[model samples]
Target: MNTINVVIIDDEFIVSETLKSYIEEYTPNLNILSVINKPNDAKEIISKLKPDLIFLDIQMPILNGFELLKSFEEINFDIIFTTAYNNYAIEAFKVNAFDYLLKPINVNELQNTIHRYYLKKKNNPLFQYGQVKSLLEKINTPNKTERITVPEIGGLTILQTSEIICLKSDYGYTDIYCKNGSKITSSKALKHFCSLLKNHPDFYEIGKSGIINLNYISKYYNEGTIILENNIKVSVPRRSRKAFLETLQIQ
Candidate 1:
């Protein structure tokens, strides 16, 4: 059995310790790397150590686990949120977070989560990395040009791709803001829409989770963020900043 590296992010010291002990006692092959209390600290750990598994807590004073997860945009790790809240499970899974375990720690449930995590990691390479890549490929499929299919809450709404002001990632869905003052959520990953819309020359893949319709962009400021024609502000991730700027001339 290969050793699985793990990190625990919870404000509760005892809970972290408990899970650490449980992992050590039952899963001999699982190595407990480090337990952290701050969500921000997890970012540094993630960059440096790159732990395969993380036991994250949903509710925290500052950033919270989900925000921490969102901050990364591009995650190569598998997460198991050890939260007291159950209401956010649906939302969490939407962003591709693998599993959730409620607090007051059940050993059996923890074991089950670990088992499921391994299975998912082994089986779904698409969920881990390929899905995002596949979606990106679809976005870059088209160099530049025209209209996009705007999926609404009720149904599909076709809108000119050049009229799109900005794109935002909500959970797993993409919200498209158009020049007509209408906003619609795409029924797929932002990357999916990016792939399909990338056919339009005016579209720019701005952020890790956003694509901006450059024709509607008013100005670029504060490094990577831009103001759209509709007065909407769209952010460009540091990773995609260069490409976003370069794509501005695609038309």
Candidate 2:
């Protein structure tokens, strides 16, 4: 068994880490190289790391898995796409026989995918890369893109506007807190995202560092703070209080 180096790219931290753990624990000669969640960083990492296999997530924000593949002139390593949705399964397999793992990855399916790769590569040691455009073309395009594209460290996170509870700034980055209790730390500043989401009327700026979801407000406090549905308290600074209160009243 050759020591195969592996890199994983997924917007979800838990999903990417879980896949890393599963590969390391179950695969005989697999070496988990790196786990990245940002799509922009993936290209640089992939070029520098030079992993034998890459576990990629398909529906990342801004730049998707397919877009990433299209950027490369020639692919040197194998790619296995991980997708949460099932709509792309048949088309994914159709494109160059590349494999895809549905979210909540099944243990047996994972083993089979790895085994298939080992068998194919063991015999040839040279796997040809496939064209991503054909499959991408046939896929459904959203009539209106309702998801917010947030650029994070290793990849991009595509989240529903409703799912986001608030945006909190820390140092240079913005923390996107979700209703599901997931937080995405983005490379961009809070103001940048605040501007991008300006079209969405529900986002409210609390003071200088906080942006709260008006739809998820639990209660407003006398201290100019508001509690969110998930018990997260967002403070409204004195400067923004009058406008904030007015906005709340109108809503």
Candidate 3:
């Protein structure tokens, strides 16, 4: 029966405000933590607000919801992605995000999301925290990643996690290189993807700039440089010495 703290973020001023009003009117047990229009600002507020639920927009000018998710090193809150597009819906479910709601929002759906959020948390706070930890580990690994669901940019194509050969950070965004020798730019960070790659033994984070799957390594030499299956050599960073050796030994 305690009021749930919540925040909403959207690029559209009207949509954000409208959602805020609806929550206030329909959900009396909800406490308005804050509402923001920008993803970067939302990141800062999220650290301070620590809301139980975040209603996030998938598309925005500065940073999308996926990108904003990367900014939080630790995510202990549930998120409901609010978007007009349903293309990423299945992927959203794959990542185990709390729920998804389409734009021109439906009050009933919103209420259902909130109701589930409350019941889940109220009955099993520990379980929710465990899910958060699992999600973090799943996102931080370098290889052996599960399928990633990004908003379908072109047609209905969904990118599989196994297709990724490597991940690298560029201008703050992550680039996913596939086995077919194609690359896609993602709004999320390499760190975020790394967290999601935990269960896969084939991937390893050798350094700060890159994460590579060992299955793609063509050769490993004494000098800490590895030749990938694609014939790209990656120099292991000095700090990762102990872990790199340990991982190698295990394999």
TM-score for all models, in order of appearance: 0.49, 0.56, 0.51
Q: Write the per-residue lDDT of candidate 1 for residues 1-251, one digit (tens) a residue.
A: 57888888986566677788888887777888889976778899887888877888755545656567666767787677775543334344545445777656778987887787777767774455544333323333223334444444444454655567888888988888878898887665676576555545566676567877666778888577788887998777777777666666555
- Superposition error at 232 for model 2 (Å): 20
Candidate 3 per-residue lDDT, tens place, 1-251, comes to 88879899886666777789889988899888898976778988988889987888765654656667767777787777786543344354457645677666778987887787777677877444445444435544223224554422332124666676777777777777788887777666677656556546777886777888767767777778877755666788777767887887887
TM-score of 2: 0.56
lDDT by residue (tens digit), candidate 2, 1-251: 77989999986676787788788778868888889988889999999999988998865666667778778776888878886544445455555567778666777889998898888887777654544445555653322224555767766666777788999998999999899998899887887666555546778777779888899998988778789987887888878888988998999
lDDT of 1 at 176: 80
Candidate 1 collision pairs? 138-195, 139-194, 139-195, 142-199, 144-200, 144-201, 145-200, 145-201, 147-161
Query: Candidate 3: where are CA atoms >4 Å away?
Result: 94-97, 126-251
What's the ranking of the predictions by lDDT, best on top? 2, 3, 1
**Model 1: per-residue Cα lDDT at residue 9:** 93
Candidate 1, 111: how far from true, in Å? 1.1
Clash count list over all predictions: 9, 5, 13
Q: Superposing all C-alpha atoms, what RMSD in Å does each candidate have to the true structure?
A: 14.3, 7.4, 9.5
